[model samples]
Target: MLTEAQAWQALDAVEDPEIPVVSVTELGIVREVVAEGDALRVVVTPTYSGCPATELIAESIVDALKAAGAGAVTVETRLSPAWSTDWIADDARAKLRAYGIVPPQSAAPGGGQVVRFMSRTLPCPRCGSTRTTRLSEFGSTACKALYRCEDCREPFEYFKPI
Candidate 1:
């Protein structure tokens, strides 16, 4: 039988396919974990509906839980109450910064509204410079934007706020 704590522990090792440095749990994708007898069910909310790594993430979750002694595992996708970047763990933000990717800023202070059209400068993850310019709305991944720092002349990706 799999315990809820054990299921969660297994999931904590499941890293995001796109961002290897962070686990799905750290990204706030794993919303719930339920263990019933030897079966386990996990509720996940992707960063966006069209996220390319959604399938891969689901597979990873199932594999991890099964390896952790679950007899059966099911992953459920929840789209309602859509995922928010504000859900990201604080420690994950530091890990993103260390990995040279700018983590998304919180939108809670603004009533959970993010203005996508407005151009805003994000500090460089490498040099901590506000003199940065967005090179493209999309970066290596759809959830990230390409940016370059004027101070260090380093190109980095900024995780877009949902």
Candidate 2:
């Protein structure tokens, strides 16, 4: 029988469908992992309740554990406390940057980030230019925002603060 640690290790291999740079574990989606008897139960929370990845993420979790040798896997989603960026592992943050998506700065009390400055400056992930401006708060994805890099003249998206 595999231990809880082994189960987590198996989960670490499951990458986020939207952002493959980090695993669902690093994204703070998978909250709890418990092995009871021959069955393994996992608790997951979506970044946003309406996020499309919710269902896919849960399926990935179950598939991952089962592939790891668990007799049975149960993926549970918990929305009570909600998911926060604070749960993101530091290593995952670095991976986000390396993959060109700037990880959120910090987790605000509510669902948004604590805006300390006037203008939010996100460097262009493509051209490394700070001349990026927010085009819109919404992007193709629910969790990102549209941005345009003036220097590179390329349109990109900011992962937004969570």
Candidate 3:
């Protein structure tokens, strides 16, 4: 009979499969958790609709809660409001930058305008410099962009804002 708070703590312990340093909660994917009688319901929003790690994250949540003595844990995926970099916590952003991945910049409010083509000026996560060049639009994953710092001359990945 774990409380909702307890269940959240348990799920927070479950790290993201791809980014082991950040937990699923920190990634802002765990939207809501409800204790329904003998079962716990967890709502998750994927980083992207086609993200391959969504299933793994769901499985990790279930395993974590069950291991914490929670009964009948259920994971629900919600795609309505979609996940955004703005939902990412401050602590998580710091961790992401420290982990050598540039945390996404906060998008403008009501940013619904479609762009035909736009170049984003991103700061280098390693050298804290604005002099950087985009090496590729896709990095190790579809959610990231590859960049190289002109100052430090180090190639790094930038988590694209979505």
Candidate 4:
């Protein structure tokens, strides 16, 4: 019988398909791990709906648990309470930055409503400068935005805040 804690620890070895620098748990994708009888169930919430990596992530989880000596591993997808960037672990944020992807920032209190109309300046992941301009609303992935640093003159991807 695999313990919940053991299952989570095993999952630590599973990295996010999109961001290889961080584990799925570090990315806040693994919400819950429970052992039910002989089966281990992993609950996951995707960064966003319609994410192309969802199926791949699920398969990775199942394979990881099985390889860890788990019995009858099951993956459950939960989308009710939409996943938010706020759920991202602080350590994961640092990893993302170190990996050359700007991490998402928490929405300002009472500033969420205005964000829809106003654009926010994103600091460059490489140069650490706020004087970055958006090259496009989309980047290498649908979840990111393309930006170029004014100081470094380098193009980078900003993990869009959700």
Full-model lDDT for every candidate? 0.88, 0.81, 0.86, 0.85
Clashes of each: 0, 0, 0, 0
RMSD (CA, angstroms), candidate 4: 2.1
| Candidate achieving higher TM-score, 3 or 4 | 3
Which run of 10 residues does model 4 get worst, by summed lDDT?
A: 108-117
* CA shift of 116, model 1, Å: 7.2
Q: How big is the positional error of residue 154 in model 3, measured in Å on the Cα after superposition? A: 1.2
Best candidate per lDDT, number?
1
Choose 2 or 3, whichever is better by lDDT: 3
What ranges in model 3 sit over 4 Å off?
A: 108-117
Cα error, residue 46 of model 4, in Å, equals 1.7
Indicate the TM-score of model 3.
0.91
After TM-score superposition, what is the CA distance of residue 96 in candidate 1 from its true location, in Å? 0.4
Comparing 2 with 4 on lDDT, the higher-scoring candidate is: 4
Give TM-scores for every candidate, taking all chains together and pairing residue i with residue i.
0.91, 0.89, 0.91, 0.90
Candidate 4's displacement at residue 105, Å, is 1.8
lDDT of 3 by residue, 1-162 (tens): 789999989977888787777888998899999999989999999887778999998998988998899989889989979788788788988898999999887672366777544557788887789888888878988788899999999999988888
Arranged by lDDT, best first? 1, 3, 4, 2
Q: Where is model 4 more than 4 Å wrong at Cα? A: 108-117
Q: Candidate 2 has which clashing residue pairs, if any?
A: none
Model 1: pairs clashing at backbone N, Cα or C within 3 Å: none
